[model samples]
Target chain A: MNNWKIFSNGLFKENPVFVLLLGMCPTLGVTTSAINGLGMGLATTFVLLLSNVTISLVSNLIPDKIRIPGYIVIIATVVTILEICMAAYLPALHEALGIFIPLIVVNCIVLGRAEAFAAKNTPLSSLLDGLGMGLGFTLGLALLGSTREILGSGKLFNATLYDENYGILVFVLAPGAFIALGYLIAIINKIKKSL
Target chain B: MEKRLESNFKNMVLVLCAITLFSSLSVASINALTAEKLNEVRLQNQLKAIRDVLPAFDNNPMEESDTLITPDGGTLVLFPASREGERVGTAVKSYSNNGYSGPIWLMIGFTPDGAVYNYTVLEHKETPGLGSKMSTWFARGNKGDITGQIPGSKGLRARKDGGEIDAITAATVSSRAFLDAVNRASGALSGNADAVSGATGLEASPGATPVEQPDATTGATPVEEPDASSGATRVDDPSRTDTSLPDTTHLSPARHE
Candidate 1:
């Protein structure tokens, strides 16, 4: 496939959250606010891109029997670097993301892409794929976060749009995550059908 | 067929080991590079917490901090607030193991006379909306405000326990923990400066040998004296009477007024 097809594929056709439904844990957990969603999305994207490129580069050297563990170590290392960098320079965001930041090591999308695509593809293609998938994940999280934040708390990105007390409190809680993600998937499905 | 299987297993083990070594080395180096910066951020956060609870002081509180061991075996770091050569107040980094979820950490500031200047929850995992209200719920004008109250003059328990302070709505456990942390901090500061300093050095370390006690003339040894009114026995371990006092005499006598 051409570069455009490789990159755009994850953006829509194989979207990690809405289409493939990977990384549901963070999608549902940190999308309490638009900023938190975006922060989580960006951090995951950083990990995905680096892991994809590195896995593709080293795929040849890794034996088939040990490929899963090899990929995991690489992804975990990348996540650790990201975690330390955030804690040192972006302390506020680091605090806001809390435990979810470290949990990125277990994110399925990073490993899934490494096993399914990056291992088989060239480094360039893998890089494109990571960028595309990461962007798609970010978009999905941002959407879910905005919906929940606006409905559950009457605020967007922590900026109060109205009296926050007037919000539908449940949307900001755990159940609200499932409800929001469910409706968002339905909307995406409808749009894809029309397209 | 046996040779092929042996070679395959060997390759797998070699690849895993090589990858692990590389990963470990990289993580170690990055940790080294960022460790200092991480500590700086942590110190800044702590200083900010101390400043939030205590009045303004000229000296850097982080530099003036000393670790004291609570009776329950937890470490309490006391940040002494001072201006010029005089001490203003003290903000104690205290924790209580009695929270609903787990330990609740608080930075509680006390004037030299023992009245609470103010307090702020440094960290907590209490239930949101209910237990987490212990953050601001214990401040002045709030339902559980204990600001300006002396911890030793009366028990700082929730009213349910027959104390003057109100508990957080539906969060009596968290309220109790918060008050307990404040009480621990205040108890540390109630004695003369030298005695508390000596106690900090002696008690802060778990396995270290207890040092000699300071001169009795300082009158700070009264901290370990059993109080008949409080109905608590304070058995002083003879060995931990001193490790040299951490100059708490910098505190201005004016604060006692």
Candidate 2:
């Protein structure tokens, strides 16, 4: 019960994107298209999960002096795996997301997990913590992406609901990402406040 | 006591070695596992882009003679294109440094005689509603018929800005930069086809990675994208990247870089 409560905190109480504000690079960049946001999010999530598990397993084995380097090597290795997989299977999405895929290595969320949660927690708990944080981060990105896409594109996942020809263009650009992120943060805050 | 300290140090060294060895080994293993799939996917992407241009052509980048150059100035790649001997078209990844937002990487396509056939925006940091829309309807409509021979000179610019091409609404900067890159790439091939027939040439260079896509195929015809009437968001372009992330300072036109 106690473990579940701790794991649940990351999902809502301390969500990485809304609550903690980690992994802003990808959150801001890839959320232009909802699908791109989802793909990039999953890629980050996959990396966060795998790196957390691996880091937890070898936490004691790594010397304190060299742990930071060790974590980076592990995270980079995971990111490369995610990148290659995306390139191979989802080429279009891969193209859409572009360098943000490589930029996953430097995302603070993954590194924060390794240091704060994985370094001290049991392997199972570490995995859960990483997964929760990843899901939370992904949720934020998807929400922002969908909001922006609907406004900017008049559609969701490329399916035209209203009329894209009449859609607002600001919702699709870099500026859109910022505007959407702000509104999203505000909404999440509202909900938090209400609760 | 001294002997014990020596044993502890040796143990620490061994663990460090183990971590290094295993990490490299895992990364190498994952890389090897995904390399082939990555190549196959990239080939398919090249094909998909070509289909968007030459819809009638069924073959892809894999079937054509691989002549695309790598970004790092290493080996030249040749796609098995063309029928029996004659080349139909070739796509070259290129870049431009004059986007409305910033630099953009693009892929330019041309025929065997070195005439531009099509192009796509590979990657960029352009303004989304304004400059970034160059990749959508505008480029698609414009990509099919935007080519013309300048006889002795390479001409590439938006028609609005005194060039042969039309610019997208509020996206003139991207249009100019994109067309310029394509013109330069096609012009380069035109210049060197006689000197280097079989050799692959880079549009940008091997050094410029993360190349932006610029899909401007029509030299004469123009593509129309969606409208931006409802978008009043005033997020300002930071005009800086890498070394120059703009400071927010909590002002209007929230920094969107």
Candidate 3:
């Protein structure tokens, strides 16, 4: 595949959240607000990018039987580094993300890319793939979070658009996450079909 | 495609060991780099909470803080703030074990007469969107506003428990726990240590006498110790009375660096 094609594949055609439907745990858990969604997306993106490059570089050295465990260790280490950096610099966002940051180690997208794309591809292509996929995930989460925030709280990114009392409360709850995700998938699917 | 190594037992073990070793090394180095900054961040957050809960004061409440033993064997730390020479308010780091999910920590400030000035949730594992609302649920203008209210003076219980304050929607357990912490903080601040036990409703004595209510308005004196002289019930060790102030030098230059 061409360089741009490899990079842009994750953005639309193979988007992690909307199209491929990977990493649903954080997708549904932290998208309570637009900023939270964005933060989680970026954190995942950082892990995906770093792990992809590291795995691609070291894929040749790893034996096939232990690759899964190998990939997980790399991903977890990257996540721990991210967690420490976030706690030190962005304390508020760190607190807000809370348990979700550590949970990123288990996010299938990081491992999925390492197994499917990064392990087979060159380090540069893996880097681009990770970036594209990470951005795609970020985009999906931010959109979902914004939709829920607006519908549930009459606010977008915490900027009040109208009185919150008039807003639908269910959209900000767990059921709302499912409902919003379902409709969003439908909408994205429709757009993809039309294109 | 690049040729891969065979999945032999020795290869698998060696590769996995190398990977784990590198991962741990990286994690350890990163942790080392960020450990100091993390500690500073936590200290800054605590200082900010103390400021938010208490009224304006010039003296370092942290420096003049006191630790008291609660009736239930927990230690409550009091940061008594003073404006110029007169006492302003005392911020208590109080906790409750009755939250819906787990324990809830709160920094509650009280005026000299024991009315709540303001409060901030220090830590909690409460359910998000419901119990987590406790952070803002009892702030000044919110529906469950407990500001300016005395804990033992009247009903501090949730409306479900026949109190005046409105509980957060679908979060009665969290609200009750919050009130319990506030009441305990108040009890400790007023030197009415028996009131703390009564608030928990575990042992409600019909006529629980107030333990020596120390006048908090006095200049820079530690508030009445919660029967610290009575070695039997005191939880905090005498050697470290100001244990709440953890290594101030580490956090002093938090802003500068």
Candidate 4:
């Protein structure tokens, strides 16, 4: 594949959230607000990028039978590093993300990319793939969060667009996450089909 | 495709060990680097919370704080603020174990006379949209506004529990927990040892004595007249004898299911 194609693949055609439907746990859990969605997305992106590059570089040294465990260790280490950095520099966002930050270690997207793409690819290609996929996931979460925020609280990124009293309260709750995700998937699928 | 390693038992064990070893070392280094910064951020947040709840004061409340042990074995920290040499108010770092999910921590500020001045949530593990509303549910002008209301005076129970304060919609448990914390803070401030212990369903200590009401005619300023009507018992410390305690009798039986 061309370099641009490899990078853009995850952005649209193979988008992690909308198309491939990977890492649904975090995609549904933390996207309560735009800022939260964005923060989680970026955190995942950092983990994904580092794990991909490290796995790609080390893939040749590790025996195939033990690759999964090796990949997980690498991903978890990256997540821990990210967590510490976030707690130190972005304490407010760190508090808001809470348990979700540690949960990123279990996010399937990071492992999926390492197994499917990075293990066989060059380090540079793996880097691009991780970046593209991470951005794609971020985009999906931010869109879903914005939709729910607007419908549920009459707010976008916490900026009030109308009276919150008039908002549909259900959209701010857990069930609302499912409903919003369903609609967003449908919309994205329709757009993809048209294209 | 890049060259691949053969899947052998020895290579599998060796590679896994190497990866885990490297991962642990990197994680340890990162943790060490960020530990100080994390502590600094936490201290800054606590200082800000104290500043937000209490009235203006020149004295460092943190330096002059007192830690009182509740009868239930919990500790409440009282940060008494002073303007010059006179006490202005106190910010009490209190907690309740009755939240819907887990414990909830709050910093509640009280005027010299015992009325709540302001409050800020220090920590909680409540539900996001529902119980988490405790952060703003009882702020000044909000629906559950408890500002200026003395906690022990009328008892800080949710309307669901037949109290005056309105509970957050769909979050009665959280509101009750919040009230419990506020009452505990008030109890700590007024030296009412039993008031703090009673909320947790614990009996007053054997050494506890019934608190005497401060004589209203003792030249105590009206703004500083501690509420004597709050059914508090056992002033623990002589230094805090003049402070007001909140009535927490109603909170004793109210438990989180």
Candidate 5:
């Protein structure tokens, strides 16, 4: 496989969020604003990259039947490290992410990449896959966050675009998440079909 | 194809244990490295909260903070702000557990003469558009503004309860909880020792009134003695107090720091 293709596959062709439909919990929960979505995506990306690299390094040592448990232990440890470090250094972002930070331990995207790609690939390829997938996921979240924030709060990246009072409140709530995500997926599907 | 290592019990246990051990070591080291910085960040946030509610003071309010036992068994941390050796006022960290989302914490400021200076919501989980309005809803211009009002002369309950304060649009429960916290702080500052009597119905008054409400506002007096006096309640233990508390306070302008 071409190195570039392996790296860029996650951006569009094999996008984890829109295409693969991985990591839906954070996708709907924290993408209420552009900043939050981007923040969460980046945090997840960091975890994905680290876990992918580490899992690839140790894949040969683990038996197939116990692979899932091994992957989970590694991912949980990385997540705990990330959580503590963020709480200590990036207190603002840590608080902003709140419960979602710890929830990343169970984020299927991290574990999925570890099993599907990292377990079978070399360290360098696994790293690129993680990066590509992370970027794709981040972009999807940003798109959703911007859509929700714009319609629901009349703001972009915390900047006000219009009278916030006139915003459609539903876009920022639970139902709004489903509505926006459904429309976003529909649009992406149309784009892919035309391409 | 050569059969890879079997998923035998021994192999699985060994692999899992190895991963757990490595992860544990890595996490422990990272935690050790970041723990101090996290504490510093938390303290800075607290300092910022205290500064937001209280007026300017020449002395360092952080060092001057003292713990006071409220009439209702809650321990309040009072930060005294002073200028030129004269006591300006005090900010009290108070909590009301009656919030719709459980406990709501507030940092309330009181002038020397018993008027509200300002207040800031420290922590809360109230509904966003409704109860979360407590953040700035009680400012000087908001409909439920509590700034400059004397909770002593005018009662602290919402108008729904026959008091003068206004409630949030759709968050009466949160509004009541907020007022209860503010009133508790005000009661602590009234220096009547039996100040909790005024804050009844909102709090759980267990049994006998035990602790003397030490007037920390009389001068730069520390709350150590009153904290010791309230040792019987177990609620006022200095070690067990919610380390970061909020409320209004009695202003004593003495330079203890």
Candidate 6:
């Protein structure tokens, strides 16, 4: 029962993107626009969820001497699959996401959950853990993206809010990206605490 | 006991192998499912770039390769405009080191008679706020007037330097780098000064520039062609030239304007 509780905690309480701050590289790099962040976050989630389950099923079998290396190989393999699928189908999103797609292999969120929760939990629980963590990261990115996009361009997903003539162009720039992300994270935490 | 231990190790290895195989299979399946759309996206990006630059082809733009140039020295991307096999126009991807952010990549277009059709910034790591606005800040900057005020292009200036082009307020380095990139790219496009001077095909309208004032100010004008014969040249080097371009080809005063 507690294992299930632990699995559900990843969705909010111990959220990887919001609380742990495990994967700042992708979190900052891809959240330029809401769509880009969402695409990248979802892609990472798929890789994480799949990798978590595979690692758990093989954890007992992997020799202690080779666990880290084996886990990496498994993670890398999953990322490659993701890379191929993006390149072959969603090339626009894939190209827009660029090298960050492959970098998902190193996202601490995926590996942290697998090691901390999935490896010890049953496969079903591990799957749930992956889904929850992925959703949390995705929401984080979307919020980061939304905040930047709305302020910088005055548009949400390309829909205009204010007149283009008066748009706050800075929000779209790199510095704006950093500033928006910092506040977004702060605000999300505030909302969480209030609840 | 030793035999039982040996069998367990074998089973463990088998499980790892099976997982690897299953993961790979799933990836392959996803790749197969999405390959077609990926190709479409790549094709769309190229078509879109050419369309933005060449305002002449306002109608149907064929998303097909007309001519492929395997330049020995530099990258060559040739998008030729042809109707019923008759030549219409051409756009070339060229580069310059004079750019502030190292080398700048630009796509210059020429009408069949070698007139300056239009140009686009392909990619660069110039400062974010200031120089990136070259497409926007000075869209109305007189073409032939080098002295026309831009924010960062002024002497020793970031936006902090208070050049006409506003530095990205915070990202000064990137702003200055972008100003330098446009200067180099513009010089190459004009084929007027020494940077990479070449035959200014008639479309260049040498004496007549957009909002033409005077050919008075001498910017870092270079010959447009960077000699593709020598492998040392980065001019049209295909390998060095791969980067994502914006959807529209028209050089605007927006981000990379």
lDDT of 5 by residue, B68-130 (tens): 665345677778889888888888888886677667889899888778899998878776546
List candidate 3 stretches off by more than 4 Å.
B68-75, B153-155, B192-257
* TM, every model: 0.78, 0.71, 0.84, 0.86, 0.82, 0.64
Instruction: Evaluate every candidate with DockQ and list the scores.
Output: 0.29, 0.29, 0.79, 0.75, 0.52, 0.35
Candidate 2 lDDT over residue span B82-120, tens digit each: 544556666555555555556667666666666555566
Model 5, position B64: C-alpha lDDT score: 80
What's the residue-level lDDT of B90 in candidate 6?
Answer: 60
Chain A superposition TM-score, candidate 3: 0.99
Per-residue lDDT of candidate 3, residues B62-151 (tens digit): 888877655457778889999998999999999876677678899999999888899999889886667888999899999999999877
lDDT of 1 by residue, B1-257 (tens): 01111328778888889999999999999999999999999988898888898888889878777886543367788889998868889998988776776788999998877889998887887754457668788898987889888876343766866678888765666777777777767656664232234534344333221222234314454443322123221112221232111112211222210
Tens-place lDDT per residue, model 4, A1-195, is 989999999999999988899999999999888889999998999998999999999999988778888888899999999999999999899999999999999999999999999999999999999999999999988998898889988999889999988888788878899999999989988987898
Write the residue-wise lDDT of candidate 2 on A17-129 in tens digits.
Answer: 78898888888887877887788778888998899999888787776766787788889888877777777777777777888988989999899999988988778888888
After TM-score superposition, the amount by which residue A158's alpha carbon in candidate 3 deviates from its true location, in angstroms, is: 0.6
lDDT tens readout by residue for model 1, A73-99: 999999999999999999989987888
Go through the candidates in order and give the C-alpha RMSD of each one to the true structure: 9.8, 12.3, 10.0, 7.9, 9.1, 9.5
lDDT of each: 0.77, 0.63, 0.81, 0.80, 0.77, 0.58
Clashes of each: 1, 46, 0, 2, 14, 36
Candidate 6: where is the Cα deviation over 4 Å?
Answer: A2-8, A163-178, B1-44, B55-73, B96-106, B116-257
lDDT of 4 at B187: 66
What value does the interface RMSD of model 5 take? 2.4
The predicted structure with the larger DockQ, 2 or 5, is 5
Best by TM-score: 4
lDDT of 6 by residue, A1-195 (tens): 566675567667877777878788898877767898899889988998899998777677665555665687789889988888777667668767878998998888877877787667778878888888888888888888887777776778868898744657777767777787777668878998799
lDDT of 6: 0.58
Off by over 4 Å in 4: B71-73, B192-257
